[model samples]
Target: MSDDQSPEPQIFETLQPADLASRVADQVLRAIGDGRLRPGEKVADARLARELGTSRAPVREGLRLLESQGLIVSHPRRGFFVHAYDADELKEVYDLRECLELHAAEAAVARMTKADCARLEAQVQKLYDLADEGQTQEQVVQDFAFHRMLCELGGNSRILRLFDQIAAELRAGIALVGQLYDDPEEIARSHDPLIKALRARDPARLRAELHEHLQDAQIHVVQLFRTGAFDLTNLDKLSDDQRNRLLR
Candidate 1:
């Protein structure tokens, strides 16, 4: 191929839809999730295509998929940037998450099983493990997974679907926030009450525990947003220092 010539555009080879999305998101989206790509930073599709040794076609498609997930936002003329939710918007997101999650908890009590209880216990253990390891982002992701597991146990398809729909945004928020709590173990230990309530098969207790848990999170998010702890003013590449700032 001549230097002046454009390379042929290549299409993905017979990958399943989920597989295709995974391949597409493997690099750029992970960068966003892991904080390599900061919120409000621009995503250049052509650069991604070149780096991935593919065509721009699938890169754009992948970005569209993320846009649908609320991980990336698109502007008519400005293209795509990592989605940045204001404090008010994040509070609203948490409210919706809490609403559906409480319902999921209520439904899960009647359906709780030994296996389900065991799984929840394992997840809680994982949270503590991750916290001890000081993997802040990983632990936050696990926290979301624990809640998501509860929804799955609830066995309500629509409710689970809705929770998954908003989960990506919530995960991003929690992972990047600097001060969810002063101590990471505090975050892990907080889930114990809910698990206890679940094991007892006590609807009233489970609902109260779950509600208080989510409400405390909402309060912190609102306070963090007010304090401007996330440094939204700078939309540049995530540096080690900046990432460390949010890691605790």
Candidate 2:
């Protein structure tokens, strides 16, 4: 084709704000995981809209969703920025997790069905196979599923809501630690004891194992930060629309 007769690029339209926001949220969260969006960076609405090839409305909604998940923060007049977990925030998150998980364990013991436990066992088997196959990310996902199953078995809506909230925060940290460590065996070792305890239906041991697992994750997160594998400051670049979502 001649220079003056360039081929027309594909033009797709009909983007829905709610759906677009969800898509934006997923993309931004993954970007955060991969260190593209550093923690504490301002998220500009206009810039993000421009980058995503969409309008600011959906970006605002998406930012709101992420902010609610504790992934970002909004400031008056300034804009939205990535939210970082300080020492106290970190401790509180894990401590709450420990309490919720302990309660979940007790509930699981009292209410878990043969089928629920069987499904969990199947998850454990999948993790073992993934570990053996050396699929690190798949193993991490399965590991999360295993604990999520225990939480679901508890049969409590309040606990389920809290678990979902904490799980989102935990996933970011888990992904960071896994990338830094690059050791699936270590992850398996940590998970195996928890699985065994759950299998035995021993609430006491289950609680202890779950607590240990969170502690191990916390330590790994710190280690990753110290080694410069993860940085919180990268979020300073988020646009206002992104931050507003957090504050709202």
Which one is best on lDDT? Answer: 1
**TM-score for all models, in order of appearance:** 0.70, 0.68
TM-score of decoy 2: 0.68
**Regions more than 4 Å wrong, model 1:** 1-28, 125-142, 157-165, 176-180, 183-185, 231-248
Q: Candidate 1's C-alpha lDDT? A: 0.74
Candidate 2 Cα misplacement greater than 4 A, ranges: 1-38, 47-69, 86-88, 177-183, 231-248
Model 1 per-residue lDDT tens digits across residues 1-248? 89999986542233333445457764565566446676789888776666666677777888888887777888988888988777888888899989999998889889988998999999999989978898665666677778888988889999988776665456435654335767888888999999899889999999999999988888877776667766543323334443333221
Per-residue C-alpha lDDT of model 2 across residues 1-248, encoded as one tens digit per residue: 99899774422223445579988777777555545566677788777777777898888888899998888898889988888766556656767877887788778977877787778778877876877898765666666667767877888888977776665455445455446445666766666776687678888888887787778777766566555666444223334433322221
Best by the TM-score measure:
1
